[model samples]
Target: MRSCIPNVLLVSLLSTSAVICSPAPSAPPSKGTTIPLTRRSVHKRSAAEWDEWAVRHREYVTKKYNGQVKSKRASGMNLLTDQDADSDYYGSVAIGTPAVSYNVILDTGSSDLWLASSSCSGCASSSGGGPTSAASNSIPLFDPASSSTFKNLTTPFAIQYASGQATGTLGQDTVQVAGFQVSDQTFGVCDTANGVLSSPLSGLMGLAWQSLASSKATPVWQTLAASGQWDSGVMGFFLTRFGNDSHAKELEPGGQFSMGYVNDSLYTGSIDYQNVPSDQVAYWTLPVTSLTVQGKSISLPTSGSNQYAAIDTGTTLIGGPSDLVQSLYSNIDGAQAGTGSWEGYWFYPCSTSVSSSISFGGPSWSISPDDFEHTQVDSSGTQCVGAFFEVNTGDNTPGWIVGDAFLKNVYTAFRYSPPSVGFASLSSTALGENGVDGIAPSATIGSPAAVVSSTGKASSNKNDATRSRGFSVQILALVWGAAGGLLLA
Candidate 1:
């Protein structure tokens, strides 16, 4: 999402705070832990390039999941990354006995963890072909032959995305995150990959429940939960945003990923929890009560598919029905349909005010004006690309995917006990003085702020389903090198 599309053009930015309707529980993790996420180091690309990439990225995801693709809605939780270059995020995950180091994208949208294999075709070193992007060329490839602990599984693992597909053999290895390690974890080692799978990211780690895992094997978090890594199957994500002006820094901590522990210092006040609807449990899906633009509540059309929303950290932009997207953008001053290479993307006057917010059930989250003014469409910075896109999945189906465009605004939490999602304002300390914390001032979101668990006491009711691991919104926009050069701001 561009940094400057707030207001009608900015609804995607405010979307980051889509809170659930359920009340937050009282208890915080008594002994929470933090795993710092390092952003991928990026080669400088201009705002126009980023906007083009976002369009292709959105198209890739839409074609992969929506349309006639017909893939199961796998339940996966992503301790997703907030990419500084707006490409994607990666984290350190070790596999094998000697624990070979690899940086993988923390994707919540899809299941199955796959990596480039020593025998990969069309790979950078292979003859078939290799990565097309400059970013993908510098990535280190994985060689199963080097990992002593690797055991091949003939499960015929394969995954399809809008960009490309990863087809490889299944294998078991000891997967480690932070200090918690899950032995004999199943993963895919790609023998061949094309499309987006050829990126610089070494691999991907899926955090969703076991049900959504394509490997049909226990996911890393499930393995950790079974091993008593934490009290419950909870994953926390803290997504941070970097201003366009901060490009000079070699690296920035774009966000954080918490597996079994919560860091209380990352957020302010209490956390608001929302239940994941029974029907939409595969994803961290929730209901959107309303969408407010310029202080006016825009009515959502009820004629289409079942209304539901998925909190997808793997995505860079937001996706909605064509009618809703057109309606939302209609509120912007100079918004127009994309043309030529910018097709499927929305364009608007760069100087427009994106004063808007979205409501899940509780608080109305105002999109940041800076987030709306995402990137200048040209060197003049007079026009910007809008973050929201239209992905018409036809009628009589599910739609609406909220990605990083909206997620970077608040601290997000995912709980597996009852399968719910939660949102809270960024702690004042993290935001400093100028950062927009919590609900935006004067946006007039929803009713009074719901009660937050001040006691940090766990909920005693077994069926309450409100359990969470508290984490804040600070992350590294660059990779964590062996030398401690990791940046997490």
Candidate 2:
């Protein structure tokens, strides 16, 4: 269950954290290129108020799961309906031949690209920037009628998330990101949208695999990879957080999303890689060997079919089985069951530090303590909301939803060849510990280099052949084509 209760609201209700590791050296950054990313605050809502809403979303997910599980068991269905919301990183893209630019949120959890349409009715409409109101120049919408290269497809499309639904016409056009352009890209021009999707955000670009896509059309990244525009087929993400803390306070120039190559300087230590299970490949899901809080292991059942966890950039909070969630908070000092602020939410003293981390396959990756508290009342107040919540996926499989709160600590790489995800600690510079020097430092000592075999192991540092950075551009392009239509925005 996903909540459209506003991403900021969800942030104020959950808590979690992780640790750091020494950095590693790489041959050099692949001919990868990066596009600037920025954080957009979900303004106007109070911390307490957002917490209340977030708790309700947790209950909603659980309630919906319980109700659906019974029917699914009786009917023997295996489809997964994941939630989407609370994205903070965004970049710009242009659609059509003339290239009309629109600000779009990049999401790794879902697989679909959608934007507001000129024909949208009963939707938030405005223009220009600076605190917009409805019924004006909200955002520049795509009009298929105006674009000479637009191809109107018969597929009527819709996507549902925690907040609301987006229903629109499916069409194809030339889409441009930075200077690279992909022709005949399929996307949705939403005529109707619900929740607070208007005003600031104009569209969403999905980055997950094509199996999760709403349309059969090829994804944006697949097209770009096949276009021979990049040196490698890989895509990388660096997400920034918003707050007063030095570690995560929003970036001055902001975070970034790299295409075709990984940035060697944005992270430290070796990256740990995990293959997305064949069944869960549609999402960037991974097997979670264990979960710990401050080095203390939380006893989660190891014998369940739902042992995997989805590392979602589109989501804002961490969630899991009700029991596991409770157990995690039980170890924290001053953590309490939410009361007037909200239910289903666990509140802890603002000063509480949860040394939390999660293991996918290899060594456990740590989360920063500063990322744990989503909301704080008064500077010296007694309570702050956490970033972990309880949400049951409506199936016997009990998977975890790991979101931006946890991801911001690591530099993630989505490799296409072997269908795996890799994580390494963010560079100290990226973590904001040294100073305001915006430049990312060289990676630290570790073995997150590319895989040498199908077993997901790092090769010897002397050989350095395991890392995919040395792949010829032609080979990389072929891998991108063989990667079977996964998309990224």
TM-score of each: 0.74, 0.73
Each model's total of backbone clashes: 38, 33
Per-residue CA lDDT of model 2 for 1-489, tens digit only, reads 111112121111101111122223445345533433433222334454454445445643443234222332221111112122123445556676455665555666656677777676534421122223234554456667877888888678765534445577788886655334456678877776553343334576767776656575656765555444445666776665444333432222336666667776789877677887766566677888888886688876655645777776655568787788889898898888775546657888886677898888877878777667765554466777777876767564336778777877788888765678899888966666322324321111122233221112223335343333422110000000011110110
- Model 2 poorest ten-residue lDDT run: 474-483
Flag regions of model 2 displaced more than 4 Å.
Answer: 1-33, 41-48, 55-87, 125-135, 194-196, 226-229, 246-252, 303-305, 339-341, 377-380, 396-398, 433-489
Best by TM-score: 1
After superposing candidate 1 on the true structure, give the runs of residues whose Cα lies further than 4 Å from its correct spot: 1-36, 40-55, 67-70, 73-87, 125-138, 195-200, 301-306, 394-398, 433-489
Report the error of model 1 at residue 109, Å.
1.0
Q: Report lDDT per candidate.
A: 0.53, 0.53
